[model samples]
Target: MVIGAPASGQGKTTVATGLMAALSRAPYGLDVAAFKVGPDYIDPGYHALATGRPGRNLDPWMQGEERIVPLLLHGALHTTAQQPNPARIAIIEGVMGLFDGKAETEGFASTAHVVELTESPVILTVDISHASRTIAATVGGVAAFEEGVKVEGIILNKAGSPRHADEVKRALRRLGIPVLGVLPRDEAIHVPSRHLGLVPAAERDESRQALDALAQRIADNVDLARVVKIAMTAPRLSARPWDPAAEVHPPVAETTTRPRIAIAGGRAFTFRYAETTELMEAAGCEPVEFDPLRDPALPPDTAGIYLGGGFPEVHAEELSANASMIASIREAIDAGTPTVGECAGLLYLCREVDGHPMVGAVDATAAMGPTLVLGYRDADGTRGHEFHRTTTTPAEPTMAPNVHASYLHVHWAGAPELAQEFCDATHAYASSRPDLKHHGDTEVGEGLVDLAVNVRLPGPPAWMTEAIMATLPGLGAYPDATAARAAIAAFHGVTPEMVLPTSGGAEAFTLIARAIPGDRPVVVHPQFTEPEAALLAAGRTPHRHVLAPPFTLDVDALPPTDLLMIGNPTNPTSVLHDGEALRDLAGPGRIVVIDEAFMDAVPGEHESQIHAEMDHLLVVRSLTKTWGLAGLRAGYVVGDPRLIARLAAQQPPWSVSSPALAAMVACTTDRARVEAQLAVVRTTRDRDHLIESLTTLGWDVVTPAAGPFVLADSHDPGTRARLRVRGFAVRRGDTFPGLGPHWIRIAVREPSVTDALVEAARV
Candidate 1:
């Protein structure tokens, strides 16, 4: 495994890729597989190019490093099939610095964290062009920082000359450190960078040549034989028993029977985890593979179909050109094939994806929208996220169904009901049931014949349900209705009659839009979509002025209007506007609404507009995202008493459920609880420090990025994709209009996740 500092210009990727490439080309016929630390996609591309194997990322924050060994072993077994003697060496490229994740917490989410998880020796890559002997001091500090992270060798990059290399060697000699190699400055071989970091290797033609050049250069300078010997001497890891085939074996009675499930494979359907298909096979179902880009038909006997994630969008033109395959899959699904589509698979099932004609299976056209669709959503308890860019046509399903073909990257966290619900919905469709046609064109397949077609989706799995339910009691302990009324009275300095509780920021935004008596209102640009969407639904044009250059809000850009909406510390960019300047915009004729979704994050309540009159200044607050009660969707809007009453009338009776309402009241009343959560924000600042570290390395960071996120430009597409393969998913830059094509957004969740982000950038 190779580790480097946090930022894109770092040499971790080059070192790891070169090692893999050189090792794979050995005369011993060593078959190598690669794994990158964190949730990046680009570095894995280079790793793949080097070893002729798929590169996977190990994210401790998402799946934890425990999942790495299983994937590694599986990849090993897979390589063995290609080569009789598989190389035991699994080249892992680490994220960020050796110990720079989450906070001052040592080895929290750093490369050191995963190194400890995998028990791998580390090769520390240092940029030594400017400093020679000091490089040793740098190496010594990192080696001594953590005993668990075994820094076996150092690759000094950008060495000025032989004298400079000697100086670095002398410095390292004093510290008893081994200098693996000295790399001279070579801009010809430097990987390009963009806002999201390195562009994906698959998207670059020179990526292969770059890897080859790097490998040859390293081989010429570095002791390749010595490195190989070190790798060979590394102790073999104990076999993990997490294989799907071992955990979920089919019965002997079902030995000769074919599987009921059919999964699309090949390049188009290649994003699926091998475990998913294996799980299906173990469940007494045959998991068949088909190529969506070339297959003329689904497996003739495929009872159900699964199209996992892949790069269908990237290859949309090719997919569209293959009209025969698209038509065949559509016919099969329409004839009752239980299809489960996700990410790219979702794009394939749609009518048109990004202007290209796709299989008209799901009624919706998937367009390459200007906005990126990404977020860590609580869709099915798996807490998975979406990391792609594309918008669906209006014909898409609006609710849950058996054939859920959407961009939601769902994780199978024992949400058996979801699967069963899907199967049931599919069965309903096959039965020609109208109720099943809640949205879009429901594909009707052949009804289950001579079989019960029973599906087993585990009920909100036990452990997850406990995790989900834990929020309730913590929220339930908050103030009662009477106490909440008192807090509201204190906040607005008015009677409790003026305040009303809602579901969340969504409900608050929706209610405010419904209550406000306005025809021509303008929404500030680059804000949350809910408020503007609500206003537009109410027949309001709502002109917008997106944040201009540098993402600094300009008051002059506002459209002349009496009603204005804004998300303080905007989403996507997390830009915080000056409260004083905002107040100046609120004149006698104007009503300014602020969605302070993240105001709690900003110290000092004085930054909020709530201090102004409730009548003219509508302030919305949520205990969801801040307190991690997003699933509960609990929040409230403080405004004029008359307006609040009007907004309340627009809602159905008890629109906010008893549980949800109680949770909201409880959360708002507990000042101590809220303050306690603020302590965690310190970790977020340290994460910001890492991003600041990136700017020194030539990254163009977006300003007004104080709240748990930042935007930056990498200016290279290949770097962006390589970052993806590294287990780090950065929001693509082109999605937001004000931001240019090279811009990318990084959300600050945990310190560990941030550390991974920093590590990815350094790569």
Candidate 2:
């Protein structure tokens, strides 16, 4: 949950820290974690004191907004050795005001921004010392000012008298916002502060007692039960929680040595995001911490240097006195070591900072100024940079052969490629694994019957081919998908914005894997292998729900996961699950993906989810199977427009060829739809005939096949090989997760082909 206020000096820190302590204490008995919204190192120290766990920062401006939920999940799930208990709840203290951000007009780095990203409910703390009935106007304005901000409760801090508290409560009741607690005015309970903000909890001897008093006061006056309930009511976040390992690209070479990246640490460089270190490790680099204020030199065999933002101006004299450290930094950069410096680090690399001599790596000077240069900047490398509330301004970045220094502090969450690029420039780098690449296309050989593939036997009809060929003469210009998208949208009965034309069903899976963020992606198995394969290729191992025997989908039996992938009229199994059953699997916080690549083959398309308006439902359709355009690779995904935009963002430029775009448009036309319906009737009859032929040959075939294929349970492991030797090629089911070598999948064919297959099986 987020704790925010109307503005600064409204006792946000006091309420936030108090809530953390109170939640972790006896009656509550809950494991609590703490986070500070912006870049304030001091408040985190107090947060650490309140809760045993180390406090972390969640700044959308410094770290891109994409990193907030994942970082929060990481901090809550993983605890320090000193505090082994995982956090059950998290308390985030807002910076400045609820809506005040990098600028007065924009809510880019504000508490409200973070709330929108995480969907965490807010408990706005109002300093009631100055006003009573006016509190409603203030709190009501804040509650309704933003579209997505959910202010669950209010805390009236520093109330002058009982009468004032009653008045404030009555006004809040009229506004329909609950007053959770009220703190009486007391100077004795106030924690002392210095220039930088609140003093570090470690520096004060009475810090522990002070925190205890605050916790007691909060427990005594506040409705702790209601607050906990509010926190629990926070909606399940839609974006998959960030995983450091998943975000990093796999090592280029397994045998390559991990590069050592020297990261600046200590109080001088505390502005680093937690994901930075995780990203380095993921990119096959080892991060070693070094203090510029104390460490005499860089770590023994460093290959790169990462200098983050901090209060370097405050320690300019100490940094300058450490001549050995400055010289070592200079030597590393001069020797072609890849170095990235931001803000304070930028200042430290300059010739002089506030009249004090620095490392002199960059050809410029940094000086303390009255004007603050801070905002959410969109840079080339990072998604956004947060130059927090500060007084120091450094010169522009000095780009060299192996050095990149800038005054902007970039968050590496959304841009893992930047880390990959940085590591590739270093001496210690390797290539990704190649063994994981495998697909059904590899099974198809020349001059084979081609039952090994699921695509229709014959290619596109003559008219379809002519339609595609007609676009080839106009290929001189770039392919514009505007008309094609509209055609697909018209066919699917969705808006053009909800349609995204992809290269193929395979490309759709790849895009989904890359864009959708879910830690636990559940793949219902014995289906097409591409979905799980795509997830694995994206550095995520999806949870497999392999069905046995009948191969039916059970919503109750399925484990809880944020993202789910299921095949309708399942691939190999040929069972058509009820659409409502699939819809039941989707809930408030889940994303359900239905792979309907072969759904057009179904007689009535009864169980297809294409037209379902469920927000979380994503239907992936392919024009390849019914239209026999495998070589052309045409498909489209249907879902919420917002989700469609995210998946589209991950695609490369002009991913679909001009011919493929034409095929997609032609296949969705009214004429093509009527032809497809006719073909579906023929395919269904052919499938039933093929199933009967196989059953007559004493083979156990999965009945009621909806797709244009059938799965037969064969005890012989060499069924595929035997069929191949008899001049027929069938798919081996062993590669599918739930199936073994004894099962084989065969494409539906006419009577003549079925007779040949039956005769071949007799061999």
Best by TM-score: 2
lDDT of 2 by residue, 1-763 (tens): 8999999999998999999999899888788989999766668878887888878888887667767888888888875577787888999999899998877548887999999888999999999898888989999999999889999999999999999899989988977778899999977669887444565675568889999999999999999999999999987766566776787664555544676788998767766666677788877788999999987677755778999877787788999988768877885676567888887787788888878899888878777665555556767645455453334444544456777877776667667777777776654411221112335566677766777677774688888899899997899988888889998988878888888999998899999999987766788988888887798677555666879877877788997788999999898899888898888776678999999988888876888777637577788988888877888889989887778898999988889889999898888877888998888888888888898888887778887788989999877888888887778888877777778777888888877888888888987
Per-residue lDDT over 1-763 for candidate 1, one digit per residue giving the tens place of the 0 to 100 score: 4445433355888888888888777553457768777555567777777888777666554554556566666666664354556556777788777775544544554677877777778778888877766677778888888777788887888888888888888878877667788888888778886433566675577877788788788778888776766566456678663555544444444434443565776655555543455456545566677776766545544467788776677678988887656655664565456778887788888778778988777788776666665544445445444667677775745522336676665433123234444434333333331121121111112331100100011122243335446557655554244545556557546667666777777777777777776545777765566776676455443555667657777788666678888877775566788887876676568878888777766655557776535656677777555555655556777766666778778866655654555454445445534553563366357547756765775877777565555666777755555666665555555434345446655555445655555666677
Q: Give the lDDT of residue 545 in candidate 1.
A: 60
Error of 2 at 338 (Å): 2.0
Q: Candidate 1, residue 407: CA error in Å?
A: 3.9
Model 2 clashing residue pairs (backbone): 70-242, 240-517, 240-518, 252-430, 252-431, 252-432, 253-431
Model 2, residue 103: displacement in angstroms?
4.6
After the best TM-score superposition of candidate 1, give how far the Cα of residue 735 lies from its true spot, in angstroms. 49
